[model samples]
Target: MHDESTKQPCCNPPWEPPQVIPAQVRRVNNLIFRKINQFHRENNVDNVTPMHDWIMSYLYWHKNDPVYQRDIEREFSITRSTVTNILQLMERKGYIERQSVPQDARLKRLILTEEGVRVHEKTMLSLHQTDEFVAGLLTEEENAELLRLLNKLRKGLE
Candidate 1:
């Protein structure tokens, strides 16, 4: 065995452990989140969190499509109860509404209200800014590769 003083016990590339990939990715995600939260605090923005902003953006992206609670649950990988709670809060905030489907009265589709549209437009800019800030840390090619690898990791999870 190598001497403890001479050998580094910690893992490092090109000998890094498999878990290192996810660990590093998580750290970067947390860093971005902290930055976004810090921006909100610095701007004295309240009544909304990053999650809320993200949901609004998603709704905006699919503004024309009919979405449901289950869809949000799947997209966010959250539980039904959690989605319900969040949707309730958003409804109260006038950000979203549940409309009865023509074919099925029991099925309610999720659609962004006018206020939600406005909020989404506002937050989308901030989201892009945050992404641009992170993208600036790498070359454009590296950024594309990073996204591809991240998507691969996500597919592995699925």
Candidate 2:
């Protein structure tokens, strides 16, 4: 017979539930980021990180509109300096080019170069595969609900 009073606890005393939403979200994000980077490395796509891919994808989608560094900064919720450095690197890598608009010479518009388009298209397939892999982990209804909850959380922050 077991001695209830002398039984060892499976976990620490006064165990707390693991309900940290932000930390869980961040961990998942890091996992996805690592997976995408792995895809890039395996595909021989050099000098392109997930951040660079995202910006290039954004520029590609919004090709109809004139996008600037500020637009990227606002969209990604990053600082001007951070965006500037990333843009500079992208330019040097031939993935993007900054052009001065006639209306405001000081305002340089972001445009994806031919190389950017090529790489963006290639990397997008990997991204979509990664997304599908993640989504496949949940049921359709669960995925929908997760999206709704995530949107709610994002709106709360905004």
Candidate 3:
């Protein structure tokens, strides 16, 4: 009544369960982080500020309508002094200007200079190109589904 196929070694251990999903997510996140950092550095844009920080500051500057320093600080969850420092550097670099609002002398409105506008446009184009390059690997349907699922996940976190 002995079955050789079912027989085990005297010290055989059980198999361990696999952790796949978490590992996959971690790998994907790492890949994205590395690629973005590499791209920014290779472009010589790893200067005064990191790519993400620059992008956020650009966004804040672009939202000129009702632009306020406090709003940017709150939106980005950054310190007031940090925002002030970034704005000052950007201004010094001739990217933006802080003009006194007619209604409020104490509050200054941020405006992008002509050069800043050109840089912002170029930056947007580069971002779009990067997006297309990455998404080109996926089929149209897969891209759509991935976007939808990502939005769902983001909303859930909110």
Candidate 4:
């Protein structure tokens, strides 16, 4: 009763239903990351990564507040170790500094150095340009729907 036309070759298995969404999402994520990285590199802002840019922005925005490694870990949903590594690297690159708070000498707050602020501003401009370009590709309604669907997918994984 098997249809010979439906049979897949031995070297390749048929794509299952469950693989579609995740694969597509991953592809989109990778493509966006690469595009942003390339854009940054072209602008001669290649020292910091996309993640570092994000963290720097966070620190910049919350400059008045005391931001710590745990705060970053929570905000980004990344592991403590990963945050530590990224922060350490940023520190080594002179993008940030960990200063002990007055309340507790052991507790260090994350602060962006002057160079970090400059880089963050430069990168933010580049990112804004990229965002505008991507947004131009879709209508307002399509953009809203895309955001809703992306949030739903991310929430489902959470």
Error of 4 at 94 (Å): 0.7
Error of 1 at 80 (Å): 1.4
In the order shown, the candidates' Cα RMSDs to the true structure are 4.5, 5.7, 7.6, 3.4
Decide which is better by TM-score, 1 or 2: 2
Pairs that clash in candidate 2: none
Model 3 over residues 67-154: C-alpha lDDT tens digits?
A: 7678667666688898888788878877777889899998987777776666555554445555776788899999999899977876
TM-score to true structure, per model: 0.80, 0.86, 0.59, 0.85
Q: Tens digits of per-residue lDDT for model 1 on 68-105?
A: 99999999888999999999999999999999999999
lDDT of 4 by residue, 1-158 (tens): 98999787888657875488878888877877777777788777876698999999999999999999999998899999999999999999999999999989888999999999999988887687678877888999999999999999778877
Q: Which scores greater on TM-score, model 3 or model 4?
A: 4
Worst 10 residues of 2 by lDDT: 12-21
Each model's lDDT: 0.83, 0.89, 0.66, 0.89
Candidate 1 — worst ten consecutive residues by lDDT sum?
A: 38-47
Total clashes for model 4: 0
- Candidate 2 lDDT over 42-86, as tens digits, reads 777745888898999999999999999999999998999999999
